[model samples]
Target chain A: MTGQFPDDLPAGQPEQSATHPLPAYVPPPGDSPPPDPRTAYAPTALIDLSIPRRTHPASPVVLAARIVPAVYLGMLLPLGGLWEDIGLIPAFGAAIATILIALVAAGFGWWSWKKLTYYLDADGDLRVDSGIFQRQARRLQLSRLQSVDAVSPLIARLLGFVEVRIEVAGAGDSRAVLRYLTKSQAEDLRTTILAKAEQRTKSEDATSADVDGGEYDPAAPPNPANLANQMDGELLARVPMGRLLGSLLLRTTTVTLFILTVLFILFTIRTQGVASLAVAVVTGGVPLFAIISEFFTYSNFTLSRTRDGLRLRNGLLQTQTRTVPVGRIQAVEIVAPLLWRRFGWVRVQLTVAGVGGEGQETGRAVLLPVAPRDEALAIIEQVMPGVAVDDLPWVSAPRRARWREPFQWPFLAWAATDQVIATRTGRITRRISFAPHARNQSVRVMQGPWQRALRLATVAFDVAPGPVSLSALQVDLPTARGLADAQADRARLARLHQA
Target chain B: MTSHVHEVDAAFAPPQENWVRVSPKLITARRITLVLGSLLEVAVIVALWLIPGIPTWIAIAATAVFVAVFVWAWWLIGRRVRSYGYAERETDLLVVSGILIRRLVIVPYGRMQMVDLTAGPIDRWLGIATVQLHTAAATTDAAIPGLPPDDAAALRDRLAARGEERSAGM
Candidate 1:
């Protein structure tokens, strides 16, 4: 691990971790283990428990497990006349080639693991340096650290090792990953990092308050923001197995497949033909894949709020844990599909910077797969304090706008406050999206000829990663203009003096 | 026509008329480029007609359609260029364009991440440049084209200064 530094460090300087031996950062308030006296005596950086250095050994056995899949595919592929012509010698040669390829892959994996290393720097930043040839180093400021999670694959679980993923604020695609740490090391690192981040934010917030003459708003609640900042992995929402299964079966794909199957059967009986076999197979395959996808996505969903931000963990075969920093979330959305609405359940999703999965791993954008409506609302309140979905004065489209959406526009409405602009749209599914004013990238008011004849206009608020625009169609033009001006002013003020 | 008793006001009417229109010279510039592009299409089709055993009528129809489109486009070129306008508001910049599918984009000064000035060969020949304002969202259409070089430079500087001051607060 020390050998991989290459040119990033000077020649004579010893490892920073060995010299500092970790400091005495304070432990978090509740449910944290009592400080162990062994490392707690540091008095400088280890206010919390100190994590001892542990490296994931380069074990070749883990990659050797891949031979099973390789052998299965080798047998599955050589099925035609090529097998009949091949004698025992050629067959044996193919098997040897597969084994050789698997061995090479396992060797590469082991060598790569040998190069990865992570340690706490003297400045309390978690420094991770990995890469066999490129040798990249990442230093995450403990204060800017958001959340850390311990994940275990099937093999890793069997080996009693867990991978730790560290999420930081404002860094795009730069999350630190330390793979195959012992479970205790992963857990200890997560707690210490989160606890130290919580402590730093509290002190920073206090200092800013002092800088502003300590004039706290009398009307506001007594430090809800600070309270939210101090959370230590409180469970916010958990989806029940029954609701997950129910939501999976209740999707529109099921109905579409049923209808298509019925039509194919009817046509086959009438014409005594099998030409529709391809159609039937293709139509039937879609719903089956959807069911399998939902099962894997929402099997054991759990959402929690911690000092780091909102934490979401779900998936059955390959679980993923994502933490989005509180400040980095551009918008929040509560969506209730038509079928899910019958059971009074809604899914809460967020558009967060870095974690919205612009390209890869799209499941990270979802905060909750399926939860009771009240629970989803509660989780929103937990993440975004002061902004309540029910308290805002929602203004619906005017009565004249009935010509456009006979039933939906009456339910569609938009509301804005100093903190957030919330829009409620859709009739059957019913979605309410909330975006903070400071995060708004742009806004537009558009009027078409038909809409102009009715004095209706649409106002769109362009927030990154989320494009749920709010439209008050068929309202008087003056009212639309006034609302646009007011929203522009409010958004400008929010951006000018960010809190 | 039967119902002048509508209770609503005209929503399509913009609030103000202090909009800055594109440079009138842009019309001549675009016409020259359009004619060149049309001629290129005609050449490609006539080349295909030169091949033996190919239908001569096909090339004739293609050439005829290209000339017709060129003439029609030349007629509407002035109104299309005149429709492009932009306004600098107190907190946001409003850009309006298009004749059929009218679009209005309002970009708040604080949200601007970059202000770029670009001039193509034709635009430089016409002594005009285009200013593009890019925000965090990639989907934003916030460019104002066909401005005099001096005016474009002034606008870019002002937008850059305002962007700096506003982003500092964030």
Candidate 2:
């Protein structure tokens, strides 16, 4: 790594040219020098900023392990055809070429891993520089950092390595990943980064408060009492393995598959045949895959709240630990599928700012995959203090709106408290979404031709790009307009109060 | 019809109808594009007609339908352009548009992330530009097109200043 830096560095500093163990590159003017590598590179260093560091040496091996299987799968059929069409010599040559390609890929991975370096700059912005041929540098502002996730895939976990993914605000391209770090190193890095990010936000708030004569500070830390539960973090909720599996079995897909299988079995018995049962078995694959994937993704799911933010840990095969700052959660949603409702079970999800938008990794956005309604509500209360879904003054959609959505119109309702705006929609799979007024980006009232004819409109409270879509559909036009205006007013007031 | 229009306006009307309407030149610019697109379609139909195995009646029917659709769109363009309106409130901006599916979006100044001013070739030729207001939410599609360049610039500056003053971190 030291040798590679000099080749890229501009020619200068002849005095330090003779086999200097560290790169001789100078820090930017007025900025502090990089920390000593010996101290900074220590595994136990808490806040190792301003020092370029490489991931574990096993990064290349892990990358190759991930890639070789894909290469083999892609080349297998073509190589097989070559073996049958041509004789043994050409087949052997193709096989050799494939091996050489895989070897070259492994070598490239090693080179890229060697070149990749990440560090925190003087401004506390996380910078990652990677790519062997075309160097790609990404700078993520710590102040805008949303979440830091440490994920370990099955192979990487077996190899005792973790990947750190940093999610920042704005576009999808703002995300940065540092792959294949030792598990301990990744955890320390996450803790240090989250702490530093919180520190930066607090300092910025302090300065802004000074400018405003210490007026309301929206970014002020949440309840100090809550802060008392820091460091170790209080485990808010943990789903037992049995409950998780039970929830998976109770899902609509599994229930529907069970029903179909039973019906197919009865039909097969009547016909004295087993051939059509194969159709049911084949159709079962869809729900089977869902169950297995969901089981692995959500098994042993646990949520805890620490000083830095909310922490989530889950996954059996590929474990992930994500830390989302309290301020980053734009909206929270509670979904109760038709089947789960009978068991009083609900799934809690969050729309986090700076995370991936629609169709993001469901595991990351999920707060609780399956929990009793009361348990989920308890966690929600902890996450968003003082806002109770049941206590809000709910108003259902007007009866006239039923023409637009006959069944769902009854479920379409909205409530606005001083702190948050909540919308409940859907009939079969009920969903209620809560978004703080301060977090709402905008509000919209829309009317289609049919809706206009019925004097009805849909009011949507727009939060950051995430899965939690908070909207009240098919309300009276006046009510929709009023909601939009009032929500905007409340959002503005909330922002001012918070500020 | 007038009462229906009034009812529709009442649903999303600004406090006192202080909406700043876009330049009427928008209709002309849009009409130009419409005519150009129709001409291209006509050319394609004519080419098909000249092809060895195609029938003349098919081309004629295609041209007739295309003309009818173009005429409908051309007629609707004026109302659509006229429908575009925006109101600058004390703390938020309200943009109302769409003739058939009317929409009114209220974007708080504090939530605004960017205000973009863009002008296409035809719009520039017409001396008009578009001002797009972006909030943290990507779903907030608030764009006021066919504004005079000076108005667009003025709006952009005002929105940006307000956004800075009322900066609400996401």
Candidate 3:
């Protein structure tokens, strides 16, 4: 256990020497153009300069995959009894019509695939052109790109194609999405874009005079952090099947589903002379399906460290590879459900910005969906480098906190490091939350009638554009007020340093 | 049994005594709005009473309850207006208000994403405006109402400038 993270962490930190050895902070050459921090896109080694680049179209199999949903809808419409009033002959005719409709949908899918093309422009913006009839083109500046994710569904994986999504900050809902590229091509493209983004940030840092740059050339040296080379790749955590299943089965959702299934079986036995197999099948099948779906979604989960931030890859049926930049994560939350506490397992989630796009589940927020307590803590330490979660000093809740929230008081505690404010709460599903001081938008101290009577208060630290359930709950009134005031000051100082 | 990680810092300094009160015209603004609101309530009740099938006593009782609430609210509005006070600190701004549930919000200037000065029709008529400070986190308590229009603008500019200065490191 070397506590130091990898060498790819952003510059200007004194802790770099403790980690892997890299070049000291070097200033950019004076003669170079003053880099505009906003549009400082510099190409990394990932982009193959020798190769002649042209617009690439998506794989042809994507058309068949895209029309699957429409085919299912068509099949379900007939079963829904849409033609019940009409004769059986008419119903038969409707079924044939549905098949023709499915064919037409497939044709459109083919046309869409043909129309969608992506290529990098001279200005370094990734230009995407799409639309079968109406032309739609979007230019996503590389410097503004926040994240690049590669996802492969079961069908795509089988066909060896992957979908790449590039999220651009301030672009609103119009992020560039290149779908169904060859698996290798998608991987290569993702690395190139991420490397370019990192290079852009380095140039911005140098020109903004934020970093103590000397002669920092991003292209120089055998920089293992180079994205295309992937020389500095280090596996941080891996969730085992046993632990994943244990955490999944012990979840509140699974427990409630199991209880409902038993109740349904009991009701069926009482109402019918014989046990109704239909009720048993219907009630039991849902939870089973949900468990299987969860298993498929998070199986083979792995978290790795890259030069940019963290890289996560998981899923059995639909594998997804996502990169979360160091600055993008606003907060971190670790939850331990009632059953999970016994086994010492926890689920780690993060509050990230600009990644939750249309048609994407915010589930991308989970950094480590399920891991052991020690591993979870380790992941926290690595993701939030320089903040030691293990040795943090907590301000324990008042002794009478138990009288108020009996089962939870023991676990209720909060602490503040130089960079983050951390709080732990809950009884059944214990949650430990950490909010970076620079990212926190405001601090509030609240007192209800009962709490006021008890001279107690709760303090909530809110972050922008993310659901932050991070709070120091049920503390002495004066303590809550004191923390709120001090944290406000601390946050201000951190923001000043950030600027 | 206790392991001391680090000594706690000095206790937080309480808000300064030099708290500036909001404009007194806030009471007039509240009075106008409350009177008009109560009138609307009365109109609704009278309409209900005029219905043929409904008993007159039900509407009369509702009107009585409304009257009692209006009087209580009218008195509370004055106190609420008087309670509003704010203070500027070295790095942050403190806003204090509320009578029953005493509220105190401390928003650092650097954290403010935007500072807005708004004057509604009634507020404009009274020659006053409200200054709102917004952060990435939505904190509704960060508004200071009943400032003179010029004062509100000055406050907004000062806060915005401070926000920019503090956000440079960010």
Candidate 4:
């Protein structure tokens, strides 16, 4: 049987196996047979969440998200008071209203408390139930569990709690969340989930090997990261403290917060009345609150690994915990924010079978909030030992030229018209800047109509390809042709390796 | 009984689908019908103007807005109609559609995430079903339009039998 970079073919390309090989970087030949995870592994850890659960940690921010409605109603109580004075009354009236609001808050708090518990059944199943208003319960057999995710809000840390969500695969989506599991519980939960998935994968490898009679790589020795680095620990990377804060302050919510805050100030200035003053005060106070809260939000973020899988933990107010087995990861993407171009802060996220599908993939399950270059490398090694990331030559895929490429006629056609119309309205954009991206951005070739006019199209690659990088091809016409040609070419070359 | 008209024409029902076909004419007719609808809207604005009690300015402004909207709607419909196309590849089925950001989704026969045939009121009149194929990567949702409802339903069933995956994601 062949080993050692089987088709070590050219760059940005892999030979599709004459037979789809077990994912790479697995270990060498083993002595005895392995087990079948599906059939042999215990189903104790598996579970499908019954419904949506409240496993979100009670981070003041998350709680605040839920509380926005309540807070709005409370302030508007005066409006209701106007209605009451206009002769709308009932039994304990305002008292009842007040009680109702209080009850809703109390109800959510109670449910958050109750729904936040998650545990594994004996056979390696992970189960979670959450939500007070709408009770949700899910069960995932441990074998199919995709990833263990933990998000620690800054508040959770000061308050001593963390939120954990577990994802799984199959007929129905089964998942569990522990909103405010203790740090220890969060760690334990991740460990247990990882342990279960590992067990199942091990069993599957064993059985599938016996049945198929083909070579399969067992997992790398349990602790590749530590073994590779020795006492140096995980190599580390980070954006400067200043750059990180800049990004946090500029995220979608932060931008909206800033915009509203500015609008409130403008209103406060325009009308020197109590109503305007109150509006200004509330709006002005929010961004400050957000800035402060976000400080602790990403505080103490850390990522490392043991033999089992990768572990990430961080938060100032609320702690979040997440675990992902290397086996579950479909691919990884290293992303750079437009602003981070200055500091070179790259965000790393993974695409796994279960993550990044449907759920916006909340998928950027951040591995490193900010890191030095070497640190990111160390982390990559820990998560994926066989597939290399650091040393390979990084080539920017061809899709970055939307503004200059001849084929960009379509987008240009739209852009030119849009510019003219906006200019006529005196709303001209001073500068229309296209984002500068790195080579290796995920390039995908998807052919729809224009793509098919020439029989090609491509999706821009988002720089890094890890476990879930399968979808990031640039689907431009040439890329599509390349894909078709490459598939055939790779197939032919793979046959040579086998022969 | 089990499938088609001219596509097969061996004397069989078009097929089974949740919604019935309105007619193929709707594809092109809708374009003309929209023009006709815009004319109706124009007639309404003029009637309001002619009726008098209504302010002349409001009628003019309303008519102008309606005309702009009608033109915009026609543009959207034109683009959407033009973008719709589908083709079947051997081991996989391909559906091409999308207006502004066009998409061509390929679902290898066995890689179907989920296939659903749905019909809307207008589509009902057109006798067609919009079939959507879900994949793990939602950005590439493959959809084919204008299939006779019955064929759409059968294709949906066939895809379900052949399609791979959980509805949530990939």
**What Cα-based lDDT does every candidate model obtain?**
0.66, 0.76, 0.69, 0.46
Tens digits of per-residue lDDT for model 1, A1-499: 0011111112221222222223333445696556544333223332233343435563444545535465646754664335446644545556666677768877776777777666667766677767778888877765555556677767667777777777665444447777667766665566566555555555556655422112222233223223223333456688888888887777655866868977997887898899886677778777878888988877788876543456677888667766665666777788887888888888777776666222232122788878888877766765666677888788878877777667777777788987888788877778898878876777666766676566566777777745344444444555765676677777777776662
User: Which window of ten consecutive residues has the lowest lDDT sum in model 3 chain B?
Assistant: B1-10
Per-residue CA lDDT of model 2 for A44-102, tens digit only, reads 33546679989888788787776655666566655777665665655465556667776
Residue B39's lDDT in candidate 1 = 77
For model 4, the local distance difference test gives 0.46
User: In angstroms, how far off is B40's CA in candidate 4?
Assistant: 9.0
**Better candidate number, 1 or 3, judged by DockQ:** 1
2 versus 3: better TM-score goes to: 3
**Residue runs of model 1 more than 4 Å from their true location after superposition:** A1-58, A66-115, A120-143, A170-173, A188-232, A269-272, A356-364, A399-408, A467-478, B1-17, B40-68
Clashing residue pair totals per candidate (backbone < 3 A): 12, 2, 11, 118
In model 4 chain A, the worst 10-residue window by lDDT is: A418-427
lDDT of 4 by residue, A277-326 (tens): 67666766777787777666666666644222344556654555454433
**Each prediction's TM-score versus the true structure:** 0.76, 0.71, 0.78, 0.50
Instruction: Kindly give the stretch of ten consecutive residues in candidate 1 chain A with the minimal lDDT sum.
Output: A1-10
Output the number of the TM-score-best candidate.
3
